[model samples]
Target: MRDYVDQLKEKRICSECVGEPYLQDQIEESGQEAECDYCNQTGRTFTIEDMASLVEVAFQQHYERTETQPDGFEYAMQREGIREWEREGEETIDVIGEAAQIDVQPATDVQEILADRYAERDPGAPREVEYEFEREARYTPKKHDDAEWHTKWRQFEHVLKTQTRFFSQEAADTLKEIFGSLDGLKTQAGRSVIIEVGPGTEFTAFYRARTFESDDTLQEALEAPERKLGPAPSSLSKDGRMNARGISVFYGSSDPIVALAEVRPPVGSKVLVGRFDVTRSLRLLDLSALQEVEAHGSLFDPAYVTQIKRAKFLDRLSRRITIPVMPNDEPFEYLATQAIADYLATEASPTLDGILFPSVQAGRGQSNVVLFYKAARVQAQDLPEGSRITASVASQWDDGLEPHYWVSEEVPETPKAKKADQYAHFFGWDEHNPVTQDNRDPSLKLDVQSLVVHHIAAVEFRTTPYSVDRSRIAMLTDEENRTGDVPDF
Candidate 1:
């Protein structure tokens, strides 16, 4: 048996000195451990005299990190230490939280990343441009595609456990019986709709209710909130014999991924599970959608099917080389290239590990085909200065002046414009003067140039909004150009 005294709050103290912050207990992002000479752990809120809590956590990790030990104290004694700390009369201050990492690169710059393709020598090559960030910003998974999103698989597992806690095993069993698959569970949904859990929402509540427990525990945990109950616990507890939190499983699947993203976790919960279904818009073997080759369905041959799969978009998704994509929109051709466009519009250059695309087009509702594009992971420093087309001179956009932005080199390799390199933005749109400098708005520029978009060589092709089939172009480096047509997205 364990005994403990009640928490007391005297005059407020600053937690920065004695420790005990909220962040102390929450697991840190992978590879990042919290460390503070004074605080027990980092916290976000500053509350009065709440510092007594540190003893509970420190009693374990303090010894482990310091001694570099292999094991921690036994649970029995660890409980005792917590009890002792609860009784200890000490004064500590309120805790404060430190800001998390931020991303400074702008979306526009990354989209304009130049490669080695050469053109008709409009300008030899694009020169480096100085960049400056006006402010500080960070990337959220919601904002861009992060392939390394979850460092540990357990992160997903824990969420399931939390939600399961909300329901009783009997309920889950009943649900399984009625729905047949977890994918089919529904709300008071009249016979056809499916239920979905939200992203980042915990399953603890569901699981707790499900686990076998003592009658008393069951009664206490399952007792409906008083507001819902009429007068007494007995009367209120049995609202048709069940109660759940934020679970509206009535919305069934047309696009399971989109439905999940929209109604999950019952609309109100922490960012517990980033649970979104993957929707896909599969590209059929026939590009024309009308052309047919083999007589009597010989098209099913593995070799023939393999050729179609090799198309740029499908191949990319198959390899997990996905980029940021507009989720659940109308179906479009070459879905993979769209993800790249999405990534360029949202994240900074080379910042994300990959992108995930959800489909909502014909034949691709709940099934998501993910593409993990690693292009963003490459840095300017990875290549020599002569070859650096996208690296910035400074690390931050707001880092003073001069080195404010990622630098783009002059394109002696392709521009005819006097100061061509000085004015180009993502996808070749000079944010400063997209009209005159980009050559897109012919009326604005002196030369009436036809701004034809193509992803070709360094001869000033300024390919805006163009995506090249990476492998196809790569093959061209060795394979003959054959028809001077680089198969671009």
Candidate 2:
């Protein structure tokens, strides 16, 4: 009767008459059935049981929610617009048609929501009544799964329509928190936004799987350092995760403006599950602590994020210098130098950001490197380390020999906190590295700046892999000598 038809999908509704207070008054003289004016308008009538059931349902629904719901959700449930809600109490209510449409401020907290409503309105105004509204369903006022899903989707839609840009899970979570607490979150239509995210594991969890438009601004933003998804799958095995999220535009033939959506990934696995410690995040990153780049806790780590950005920049501007495949008997160090020469001879490959190799080591293991040599092609012999991961930035970086190349250990780019939020201190093992000689270092004080390449003795090989640091664990295998580079590849 209040003309909420626009919000409804189907008109055939259940429950009692529209408003409260206007009930069938007993005719003392005739003792005949009478209908209230409000009931007549709704085209339906409700009994006391119906009213009780509705209120019970509404309160229960509003309780289990992590997101905000709409005022309309409690139409039949609220008596005199919540003038009659008292735990284990009784009261009656009046239903004013126009008054129902007026906007009401949502209660700030549970205490406020359960407080007494004693405003003196009309003499026959609604009053709180005690009614043991028995739960109809087997579950006592349990939230409907479909309804919960719809509520979250509605919140997502609201955000998408309001802002046209990428969104983060933290932003989504923050919005949900606000909706749950702030009354200003309610929109003109009487609905509120609330985000609910599940643990993301499958590809569907990521919204970018769907295609977007070719907007110039978007393209430029997407190309930015933060926008570009790096060469890796983002090994969130520890967090420090970074990715871009955008809204999906669905254009229909009829009305263009429709439901909105802010694409966001569900929450990922927690770092604690992976034995990660947040305390270690307090340290700065250097060669000694680079591999410890993986943040330890569930919190978003900002420092880990810095290293990720730096690595991406280096990888982007990095030039790939291909090293040749050395035979088994050859020393890999010399061949690594040869590949460096060949790397200098050829023009840089557009797609090849860096040269990765599966060099045949004298030992049972194999390794990879990026060389910058000019027509240098030969086998390796008596390389100090049986196999090593070394990198050389031709022309720009001059460290090793004549052409100037640096052969250092190939450490993984440090992973960061989920959304670049905090600093952590490490709390693993005894004080081992020189950077953290003092056991009193509260957080992980040592850090790793650049990786160093050191020769390995052949004895360390036996289908065995070792972790140079926590972030990078490596193993040498016979099959590694067969294929190379990417694990699956």
TM-score of each: 0.14, 0.17
* Candidate 2 residue-wise lDDT at 134: 15
Off by over 4 Å in 1: 1-53, 58-63, 66-450, 453-489
> Clashes in candidate 2: how many?
55
lDDT by residue for model 2 over 1-489, one digit each (tens)? 213321121122112332222222211222223443333434343332332333334444322212122255454456457543323311112111121111111111111112221121233544442122211111122222333334544454444445432344543453333122221222224432111111231110111111123233223322221111111111221111111111111110100010001111123210000000112211110111121222121111223233333333222212111222234523322322222222222322211111222222321122122211111111112123223343342344356333233335433355332331111122121244566232332211111121111111222223766768556556757787667643751
lDDT on C-alpha atoms for all candidate structures? 0.24, 0.24
Per-residue CA lDDT of model 1 for 197-271, tens digit only, reads 222321101100021123332222122111111111222221110112211111112232232333222222211
In model 2, which range of ten residues has the least summed lDDT? 269-278
Global lDDT for candidate 2? 0.24
